[model samples]
Target: MSVQHPKESWLIGDQGYPLESWLLTPVGAPNTSKEQKYNRLHGSARNCIERAFGVLKSRFRCLLKHRVLHYSHETSALVVSTCVILHNIMTKAGIMLNEVEDEVAEDFDSPNNAVDSSQYIREGERTRSRYISTL
Candidate 1:
């Protein structure tokens, strides 16, 4: 079940994801001043996803403790989905996350994974260029 978005709306993705009409990605090698500015804004906006994952892991200690989910792929997906639903429900009920006095430093570095963009290369480039022009 995919969430419906308006035609003008877009989902922000990092460099690892392919760009589409509904998805926006930053320019790899921005040349112009406007392009550079657009990339900065895009990156800032995309950081929300990272922060969200960090919060999720911090809240659900089991996910952080188990580097690799022992369960099958389908089971792991369901577990994650249930965790997300519980998190939302807890948040809505005004339950605060437990605070850790001794905060452990977390490495939130993004992996440099090469994603296949051959199919959407042209379309992605066009979309990026059009958005950059508006900036």
Candidate 2:
């Protein structure tokens, strides 16, 4: 598998292992200028997502603090999904998202106003973060 992928390729992030990243090649290698440009562009886009997650995780204290009410799993799913949708709507409307901290705000990229990958990931994992749910 390594031989087929070659060390020269960059590993795109799958759903698992948020901290683990692999670059196929060393930081710099001889690639076509267009390829290099595209790689940089992709990296920048990915970084924007990272920034968004960083913001969402920090702002949504409830998500970090796990609390499970006695609702059925399916209903719980709906509730969580609704919260996420509302969060996105609030963010888009530029309403204050519960000020977390200046450091976290700084962590976010300039609001190119892009959404994050967490929104698209499997709903279960989307609710889990480095912070544990308090509930």
Candidate 3:
């Protein structure tokens, strides 16, 4: 039998993470102008994504706790999609969530990041560098 691996993709991560080809982290202590620019741009993109998640969680308290949810992956996906649709409807109806009290944000990334194939690492690096150059 043969297995099919995922195609190469680029993902941005923050500090304290190992540099993988698929995951690109901001250059720590960026010395060169290009590196500094990359960091600035990457930070801006990550900030927008974080803010979107915060807003989603604020509106849908059900999504606040990840470990508490025990649904299958498909069910979880449906729940999130429903929440997003409902949020849009509420927004259009001029409804807004009263900010929840000091609620801690949940981690949203998948927990299955153990793919360490050398081929993937090399491809991920090429993808990240190419993507960054265009940014």
Candidate 4:
């Protein structure tokens, strides 16, 4: 599948990934009202992504908890792709996912994964600042 997005369009990312023209990251610390507002809005948007991942992992246990598939990188990719395709098919077919217990689901939101140390891009900083000003 091919996807096309405008240059100005963005994907919300956590602080693990650096800010980019097409990827927005949260402000490190909000010292002003505008920065605080921006951080709030940015966080709200980012949570949607986090929640989506949580749901995906909840539906497909193998993707996160089980770690049952041990294969070459290419094979692993194929496995993930297949799972995603199956997920979509199941969703479209109205197959309801079994409700996960709160205790089990709580682990999905744990911040145990290491965050990548990506460098900040100058243009991305400017874009973020401009957007915050508008807010």
| Model 3 bad stretches (over 4 Å) | 1-11, 15-24, 28-31, 99-117
Which pairs clash inside model 1? none
* lDDT of all predictions: 0.70, 0.43, 0.66, 0.68
lDDT of 1 by residue, 1-135 (tens): 566779667887776666666787777666789987887787666665666666778788667866767998789899888889999999999987864433222211332324456766666677778888888
Name the lDDT of candidate 3: 0.66
Query: Candidate 2, residues 7-59: lDDT per residue as tens digits?
Result: 32335432222322232111122145543454355456566656665566666
In model 2, the number of clashes is 7
Specify the poorest-scoring 10-residue window by lDDT in model 2: 19-28
Order of candidate numbers by lDDT, starting with the best: 1, 4, 3, 2
TM-score of each: 0.64, 0.37, 0.66, 0.64
lDDT of 3 by residue, 48-116 (tens): 666676788888878887635579877988998998999999989999876434432222232234445
Candidate 4 lDDT tens digits, 62-130: 778567678887797898788778888998999978644332122223233234444447767788888
Candidate 1 is scored at a TM of 0.64
lDDT of 1: 0.70
Best by lDDT: 1
Q: Worst lDDT window (10 residues) for model 4?
A: 103-112
Ten contiguous residues with the weakest lDDT in model 3: 103-112
